[model samples]
Target: MADKQNVVSVSDRIPALKEQRKKRANRRLIFYLSIFFILIGIVVYFQSPLSHVQQIQVEGNYTGETREIIDQSALVSGESIWSQSLGSAKERVEQIPYIEEATIERSPDNITHYCPRTDRTAYLHNNDQFIPVYGNGKLMEEQSLDTYPSDAPIIFNWQNEELLEAFFVELDKLGSGMINHISEIHPSDDDPTLLRLFMNDGIEVETTIENFASYMAPYPTVARQISEPSDGILHMKMSPYFEAFNPEEYAGRFMKSTLIRVMVG
Candidate 1:
């Protein structure tokens, strides 16, 4: 009975030792696997070309100051992309006054992208004062009429915000050369949707806001066809056509009509 009991106790001890050995072997396998994966990650990080930035690309910059924006980004080539903070770089690029918004992106092809949108500027004329208009016709700093440049059209008595936004949208569609010929823009008193455009060549245009771009796009071609020193109203509301008028006679009629209306009233 004593010999049988001894054998049972020894058998139980043998199984416990095997279990302990198996547990140790599993632990060793897990530790080795962890080390192996960590080494592989390190090797890939150092050896892969994607880990470094090789090129910097800029887009959506309207001022043509791409180099300035890239310099401001502070993203140096050959730098480790893993260590780059894209958020911080984007913030720096947006510091430029003309840039309205900026976005940054990185790719595994070793490229860093910096995109910036510039604010659109226009001039608003109130009497003798010229105010700078930013995005969506929001007025900025005011300047004297004498100092205002002819680069942008001067808006006259345009107080409606919605109409101003639509006007800018249409104006932006026209090319810079076409826009340069426009000297002043006024909201028509007769119709809120109609706008009166005064051209640099002393020609006037009457067009609606909805199709302003389509009408204005062909203005340069139309102006060239007319006789030199031409001064008249080009009605572009429905059908596009030009009407010749004697400036002196028109002015006299205007004054006389104004006086007669005032006296009658």
Candidate 2:
């Protein structure tokens, strides 16, 4: 009887050992699967299409060549998405002098989008010819209208990006629809300066740059303030603005002029 009891006990111990071995095998399988999935995730991240720039879009750009600018930026055409660093790419693109700010984003489809930012547009004067004027207020050499394509107004030569930027800010404050009839904007380089706007109605507004917001803050006031149809070039280059009854009369008139002598420092 004692021998039989011992045999049964041994049999039970065998099954228990087998059960323990099966649990160990399942644990090992789970461990290998976890590692495999992790490796796959890493491979997918590195191989994603977002790793390379697929599209480049430039908005509010006028004078700068879009393709040329993109080529100069930090974005490399082909690379692994996981290996590519977004912050590093942005820093590189922003290094280009013209691009004030840049933004990069990856779409759901894994395409990278690069956008270069610019606040102001260069208004090239078109008078049978096109003249490149920096948004700040510097007048670049005149080029043929065919070369520079834009409908922005022509102003006298000046080189102050800050002033032009201010004008844009003021325009935003006043609302663009207020100047629908405006054909051109001429800002003078003098104290108590003015922005001479030529309207399509054969009239012009001779208001100081400082008073521009207050005067044209409302759209309806523009037509009512046209005391007289401007006969010629309007001179807003003074404190108490006066219309150039004969604009041609002041053909080369300026209260102050800053002749830009380009010196690369």
Candidate 3:
């Protein structure tokens, strides 16, 4: 009786072991098949248009400059968004000296966003030809425009790069009110460091580069005090004072030339 019970127990254990092995085999097979299907799906997803960049957007741009910046970034439509080296592309965009900064972002919908912060442009006037000078003091010599910008000040004889760069920095400090009123800027013949600024309202300003912005800040106030359209040169080197332009020389030039007073600076 004992031998018969033992044989029955052995038979039951062998069938249970075989069932567990079968279940393990089925799980492994399912896992491999799932991995294969996932790989296939990944390949299809990459090959389809969904993975490619369909649109590109540029923000905070003026003129055709942003377009050129985007082109330099090497970001284009139909390119794989996943494959693009965004950090490198951004570095390339910022390579332009005039561009202060560049931001690049990729959207989940396969869109590329690029924003390049370019410096405001000022004109270096040369008679009929006007060259663009960026706020960073980069003078674009190759490019020239015939028309003069009424809103911007025209810089004259700014040959020295260092001084011109410093002058541009001073220009950055001026507000639109003062900047728009300024028609021309030139270095003094006797003292090159001393600047002569011609205002559109007909007032001439004489000051050094050190006091440019601060001296020009009170222009509107000082201009209102004078009765004539143009009176004399406003000397702001040490302090604000007026030197009357000999009215007899330039007619319709200075409004208060009636008094030929010799005021020594």
What is the TM-score of each predicted model, taking all chains together?
0.56, 0.58, 0.76
Error (Å) of candidate 2 at residue 230 is 5.8
Show model 3 residue runs off by greater than 4 Å.
1-34, 109-113, 116-121, 247-265
Instruction: Please give the ranking of all candidate structures by lDDT, highest first, separated by commas.
Output: 3, 1, 2
Give every collision pair in model 2.
Answer: 51-81, 136-160, 136-161, 137-158, 137-159, 138-158, 138-159, 194-209, 232-247, 233-247
Cα-based lDDT at residue 113, candidate 1 = 49
Candidate 1 local lDDT, 14-106, one digit each (tens) = 989999999999999999999999999988887886678878888776556677788888887888876778888888976654556777888
Off by over 4 Å in 1: 1-101, 106-113, 116-121, 126-146, 246-265
Q: What is the lDDT of residue 57 in candidate 1?
A: 82
The candidate that achieves the highest lDDT relative to the unseen native structure: 3
lDDT tens digits by residue: candidate 2, 1-265? 9999999999989989999999999999999999999999877766776445455455545655666555655455565444456677667766654456667665432434354443333454445566544333334452335544434444444356576556655554454455445666766555425566766666655565565665665435435554655454333322223333333334443322332211111
Relative to the unseen true structure, what is the C-alpha lDDT of residue 143 in candidate 2, on a scale of 0 to 100? 36
Candidate with top TM-score is: 3
User: Which candidate, 2 or 3, has the higher TM-score?
Assistant: 3
- Candidate 3, backbone clash total: 0
Which pairs clash inside model 3? none
What order do candidates take by TM-score, descending?
3, 2, 1
* Candidate 3, poorest ten consecutive residues by summed lDDT: 252-261
Instruction: Output candidate 1 Cα RMSD.
Output: 8.6
